[model samples]
Target chain A: MSRQASFGAGLWGGALALLLTGCQAGLRPIAALNQPLSGLGDSQSPSLNSNWLALISSRPGSRAQVQLIDRLRHAPVPLPGLNRPDSLPISVAVDQRGERLALVRQRDDRSELVIHRRSLQASQVVPIEPAGVPQRVSLSADGRVLAVEVSRGGLWQVDLLELP
Target chain B: MACTAVTALGLSGCSLWPLRRQPAAPAGLAAESRQQPALSGDGRLLASLVDRGGRTTVLLQERRTGRVLPLRQLRNRQPHSSPSLSWNGRYLALLVQQGGRRQAVIEDRATGQQHPLFLPADQEPQQLSLAPDGQSIALELITGGSRRLQVFSLAAMLEPDRAPGLLESGGGPPLQP
Candidate 1:
């Protein structure tokens, strides 16, 4: 073979090998967490921590309610006194042990932010000083700090509150 | 001549390669009706919003097994939204609507207890996120016709919920699955 032909063959062979390798590398399987659920009625607004998954789902007869799943056990954890028949859940956040939950719900024609202590079986109203409308909420890892989205004077702002 | 032949062969091989197939949806969930998805820090659980027959709700699924978990207390509540979970899937925080108003609440799976946080009468909550350790929370509120974000410290009131075998601030090799 001529010098030019030899060089061309080498180039083609190298390119083919590279292409095949690229295809193989791109075939990694998708993670199961990224996939969607089936049969459940209109499940949405998912939040996850290290070992817990929380979301709102409207199953057969229920309208909409918060659902908590233990990632390690692959089962749902029951929560008592959090969901009320007259209340509508808006947003949810969980702590590490699934002991403390921060929730926003609409009730009696008003919106409020509350901290629910599972062990104590009590709910405390987190008052936003200067009185603003609370929207979304997040809890720190230790459940020591809280981040709140508020609306004041028709403008949106973020507030950091100290929990006592 | 050899070079040309080799190039032709390469081209033919490329053409014969099959196209990559699109990934199929996980076994049962064929419809793409899910929304507002959140993943746990460990990536083992997923929470998302879905609508069924004009009603909106939340669903919690085990990422690896695609199993749907149950929420017994929330059965009566309708139109739930926004969800946040702790590191171990132990604490769950969410908002529930009551009449024409909304309230914030939390559920501790380990204790099977639910706690509700009440804001001032004038303050209205919009959205919220919980820290991984369940020590602090950030919330968005609307007051006086304006919106703002606030963070509250819960160290004084609640026990620290830490993940198992969690590393402090020290530097070390990342943990492997």
Candidate 2:
């Protein structure tokens, strides 16, 4: 075989190898259910008798979509984006009656807490501050209070606030 | 030269896997979650918060199956006037916040209207539960360095307060000053 032919074949082989490697990385599924979220994953699975709300990660690259699963049927629905545009879900929660939900998203270098409610059968959304990286949130039994857990300078504090 | 042949064979071998992959639902999940759950003390209903266009919302399921029927999505998705029940289960309550304030909404087993109860969104309230009479509610509230377990009379919570500022609960502030 000619020396040139051997060299060309080797080049083609290396190219193919690189392409396969890229595909593998793209297809890999990564779940970041680690240190940051605390035991949120376990505490807020679908089975808890209350209405379920979660900050579910959807296709990342295409869009950082946040999905809310109606625990009743396990179907996911999309939520609107944060005012920051690039803001993404950090934590999620539902009120006891499942009539309200709140999500904390980090955008730019700031944290923003957005709460949504379907009251009087009408839906409303608003951004609340002190919104730095929230770890977990839950609704009270009457769906009135919202308990928020936030880490400041690596220290954790739980805030029990009226969900106004 | 043999290395070239080996390489091609290796490439073909990898093609054995779905090299041109199709993105799929997360592993272990068979289908979209669609579960209308049973309400506390109530029989069967569904309730949850659903996110739409970056906005979040609470939803109610009024059937035994707890599934959002196809055409019903429209009515349910309507401007959602107030925290209403998705399904009217015997007993279900939801915590809601609107315009920087929080309120508790309780629903009976079979109605969608936001139940008129004591714990209206009139003042600051946190962690609320309906008592047996269904008239009263239990709440945990936080005010300037204090976390108090306040069980307000249902009627007091419903009616506008007599004095303004902060209503004092019986216990000496819970957390600390």
Question: Which candidate leads in lDDT?
Answer: 1
The positional error of residue B107 in candidate 1, measured at the CA in angstroms, is: 1.3
Candidate 2 vs. true structure, TM-score: 0.31
lDDT of 1 by residue, A1-164 (tens): 69889899999999977765543342222123223223334454444454665666666677677767675564567778788788878777665567777777778887787777778766666555556677666554455545555665665444444333
lDDT of each residue in B81-154, candidate 1, tens digit only: 66666566666666777667776666666776665656667877676555566655545566676444444544
User: Model 2, DockQ value?
Assistant: 0.02
B36, model 1: CA deviation in Å? Answer: 1.2
Candidate 1 regions with alpha-carbon error over 4 angstroms: A1-164, B1-25, B156-158, B167-177
Models, CA RMSD each: 27.3, 29.4
Which structure among the candidates has the greatest TM-score? 1
DockQ of each: 0.02, 0.02
